[model samples]
Target: MTRIFPRPLTAAFAATAALSLAACAYNETLGRNQFLIVDDAALTQQSDAAWAEALRTQPTSRDAAANERVRRVGGRIVQAAGLTNRSWDYAVFVSNSPNAFVLPSGKIGVTTGLLGLVRNDDQLAAVLGHEVGHVVARHAAERYSTTALSSVAISGVQSVAGDYAKAAGAIGGLGAQLGVLLPFSRNHELEADRLGVDYMQRAGYRPSESIALWRIMAGQRQGSTPEFASTHPSDASRIAALEQYIASQGWS
Candidate 1:
């Protein structure tokens, strides 16, 4: 007996093969030519929408003094970093996660947990500056571009594979590709640390406070590790890098 697959299937497979090759070629060329793909506008739009959704869903603190402190520090860093032209906003959330993040649109969020860990305003500035560094350097968009490329590649592979299950499995294999993206993240973190220190110094905050701040953070994770560990550089590694950057900048 003989079996025949539909012509549509064959055409789809051909299309998939072409797309996969195109994606590979684009990635190779773009990777060599540029480090980032998406522009600032698109990043800002996506980030703004996400930030708005997060703020809407999460209950935030209304403490006048606490909010003032966040705004004060955030404002200083923004000005020092020459981000005055950017649409920036800062908020302190009432969470105990010891975390902070800055959106591509300059929306900044710092958890109450992080505030408790910080000893002074300067330390807070250091943290905020680092988060802002991620934004200024457009790391998130870079990640997004890579992710889009991967999605396209996977779609192409699925088209050729013809078996949805096999396609899903192939897509699942993207963890390694994602892991390869980490070096870029690490580089961004180091750059942020350097930029944060510079911003703090210019804002009249002692850059040395960053060292103390990270030390305190490292000490705080005595028993359990936080979820951010997966995405963020390890505490020891980050602190060491920050120290080296500080020393190089002659911050002492």
Candidate 2:
């Protein structure tokens, strides 16, 4: 019934409360409570499948040395994060675009472009540590939960607003982005940056190189999206935050 659907933001807040206690978990590492309907096991399973698909479809390099280098640096990072419970796999993908990613399944994929871009192992560790932080922080699960709840909220808005439903739904969606989704994404990146430096320091890598790595990435990206609309923080913002954090930790 039309009457059954509550106002968009109202439904979102109401559901968020009910989803608490069970769904809202406090992460001591992050020092925040997260709304997570999904678990790490589920994320790992999904990532494992995606890793398989990527390996099958992507042009993976047979370069033995490159693969070993990734394994070496990644192994240290995993150890530093105390996430050595799972077996970690590393692969080099033949791509010119400087990029890297880590799956929740402890699988890491690095582009040859990224390998060529890094000036040293410390820089590589900085990059890899950031990806590992995403895994350790369970950012994927939190993002999934937020998206699922936001969709339900938008649908409620559409069902209840009648003639104005489309407009109401748009407003609700935008509200979710500005108030919840985008902020969470940007915070996640910043958190990962901080965590990455922590791991780099623990792994005996120079924490300063993380800043250097990000600066190079900034040079590669000409004009960036504004911080408010963008998911990731701008390079300048990220660098400034990292500098502040590294200094607070008394790391050069």
Candidate 3:
């Protein structure tokens, strides 16, 4: 039976290859191929549900100005990204962390701290543009596909290990961590940065403010987990990349 179970590993690889054959598609905007097992329809449905859950559970800001600012800036970025066909919702969460996120379903949530951090509309546009870029790049679907592949690979290993898999709590834990908690690659971050500035510029937001925003973000950073272990590029690296990209565009 152990021998038989080991054969499932081979079957698993075959399954992965089969999955990849149909899932690999070229994204012209990103200028690359993405491995995506989930289609937009399904992804949007899932994201809508998640967005609803977040709005329901999270403490949201009622500050009219903050809410209006995010919506106003976000609208321009989404339009620039050519993603305005969908109904987009923006909310400000009452949190100290200066962060924002965009759902695949065209929902955006920003922290009040982020509102307080930006010096002007252009800087806020920079952050919103980056989040919009992630959506236009179809990063959420790509991330889901990668996580699914990780699970498939982990299952394959467990099959080969047979009874030993039951004894490997550490391996199981690592699999969960890799499957869920791992951040997007630095390449993804850089790509998003470039795409963001493109949208910012197209929307008539000063491209140079994007650089300034990152510099401000870098200065505000006190400490973070090492870059190797983080899902984001180091602040210095991200800022430098943004600077290089903005210069390449000749945007002052």
Residue pairs with colliding backbones in model 2 are none
Estimate candidate 2's RMSD in Å.
3.1
* Better candidate by TM-score, 1 or 3: 3
- Which segments of candidate 2 are over 4 A away from where they belong? 1-13
As for candidate 1, its clashing pairs are none
Ten-residue stretch with the least lDDT total in model 1: 25-34
Best by lDDT: 2
Instruction: Give the higher-lDDT candidate: 2 or 3.
Output: 2
Q: After superposition, how far is residue 47 of candidate 3 from its true place, in Å?
A: 1.7
Tens digits of per-residue lDDT, candidate 2, 72-122, equal: 999999999999988999999999999998887888899999999999999
> Each candidate: how many clashes?
0, 0, 0
Per-model TM-score on C-alpha atoms: 0.78, 0.92, 0.90
Q: Residue-wise lDDT of candidate 1 within 143-206, one digit each (tens)?
A: 7766665555455455545557585645544553545455556666777887788889999999
Alpha-carbon error at 193 in model 2, in Å?
0.8
What is every candidate's alpha-carbon RMSD to the true fold? 6.0, 3.1, 3.2
Residue pairs of candidate 3 with colliding backbone atoms: none
TM-score of predicted model 2? 0.92
Instruction: Report, for every candidate in turn, its global Cα lDDT versus the true structure.
Output: 0.75, 0.90, 0.84
